[model samples]
Target: MDTTMSADTVVLLTGGTSGIGRVAAERLAATGATVVAVGRDRERGRAVAEEATAESAGTVAFRRVDLADRSAVRDLAAAVDDEYGRLDALVHNAGLASATRRETADGVESTFAVNHLAPYLLTHDLIGALADTPGARVVVTASSVHRRGSLDFDDLGFSSGYDALDAYARSKLANVAFTLELAERLRASDRADGVVANCVHPGFVPSTGLYRDVSRRAKLLTRLAGLVPGVGTSAAKAARRLVEVTAAPEYGERTGLYVGGDGPEEPSEAARDPETRDRLWRVSADLVGVDPDWP
Candidate 1:
């Protein structure tokens, strides 16, 4: 909790305009780390950046990027590389929960594209920047719902029988698998020393806009469910957890790990499978048009 980062340290955080990402951005900025907040809404992004800058000791900048668009994500990475030659942390927290199945311009499912592939591609594109920085970290916002999810490589996009919860859960599962595979690859690549990747389940946060696209009934149900004891945590608390994983010295050497409210916990059986992780990596790379053997 007392971890202090240098002012020169650069953090690229998606979904920083709102919810847990916003809180994390503010908290990290207070630690004197330069925070680059990415989001689709330029207005909100600018407002959050101003607020964070006013309240924090470090600098906070905003960047616009549509996570669902591969080209846009690539452009965002390019811009980040151009501005900051090295990155200290890459936090992926942007995601959506849709009531109905939808496809992106890339012809991939909207939920999968936004939640999983976007982070995969963005991380793949920024690996060099991260590798060059010592002790760089990758923190993915995943979910415990992954425990109830299953992946079918044959139909990863969920072209048929698309259930909202099932799609969201699968995407979360992919988040875990991606983290595991990314940790392994970073170890094998150049400048792997001190570079680590980990995922966190922020618990059920019903107050965020993540479920805005879901039906009213579903939204009501989630709000009701969140009222139960031990069911949900406030967005600020969840964001603090992310800040801990991102800046805490204790987790600096941890990789391919899953951390929840109680600390590091075991992911689902599928999330622990090497073969599944490899397959998911390859498929994700293919979907996003990135090289699987990226450095």
Candidate 2:
């Protein structure tokens, strides 16, 4: 895959301060793309940008964004458009693994808000900028765990009962569903030729910051799992797949594809359900206060 980027190519990446996101940001920057790395921590964001810029041939800029807040996500989209005018690629790599259920300021489940709704809202807000840019791509960091997920629309926030793994898996499933629907929407729009959307499972990288909120026992188990062959991968290795899916010329025209370690793989039955995808899109749009049938 050709890793070089045009001088005008601009990529916006979330959760870029650590894990695969961080590694991918630096790698993309090294390929000469202008990378806007978004995160909630100001200091860590700045440090990641500085380190990536110092080591890469391209430019990396830090943008503070709290994915849990819908309003903040909207502001981020506007800022990106105002600053760059065009977004070549938008990589939704931010994720959360909560040990216990919590609610966001928006009165939504924290895991769902951060993992799924954030990307959904941000992409919706940036649709115009993305459509305006040629060969624009949307890359979401999903998970293989989505296969075990079951989405309960009536209790999306898990008001009745909540399990950390269940919540996380459901959110990952939402990511895949969202991408499938987004691809269809973009394809039906006038700018179909320019914009595309896809999601990927970056492989289980237990060493990443994603497990910080989990229990110590869970963390130890993940570490042990990582040591086993074919169980987990390093953040750096997983990040290469992210870059390939997000920026490589091979995947430029592909939309709604679920990429695993090797290449495009079939997603779970739930994720591939058209009705579920449409319902999730509508519900997500309503929650974020955007038109459900947006271009």
Report the C-alpha lDDT of model 1 over 1-295, residue by residue, as the tens digit. 8773788999999999988999999999999999999999888899989999998899789988889999999999999999999999999999898999999999999989999999999888888888888889999999999998889999988887898999999999999999988888888876564689999998788899898899889999999999999888899999988999999998888898899999999999999899999999989889988778865
TM-scores for every predicted model: 0.97, 0.98
Clashing pairs in 1: none
**Model 2 alpha-carbon drift over 4 Å, by segment:** none
The alpha-carbon lDDT assigned to residue 3 of candidate 2 equals 57
- Clashing residue pairs, backbone N/CA/C < 3 A, model 2: none
TM-score for model 2?
A: 0.98
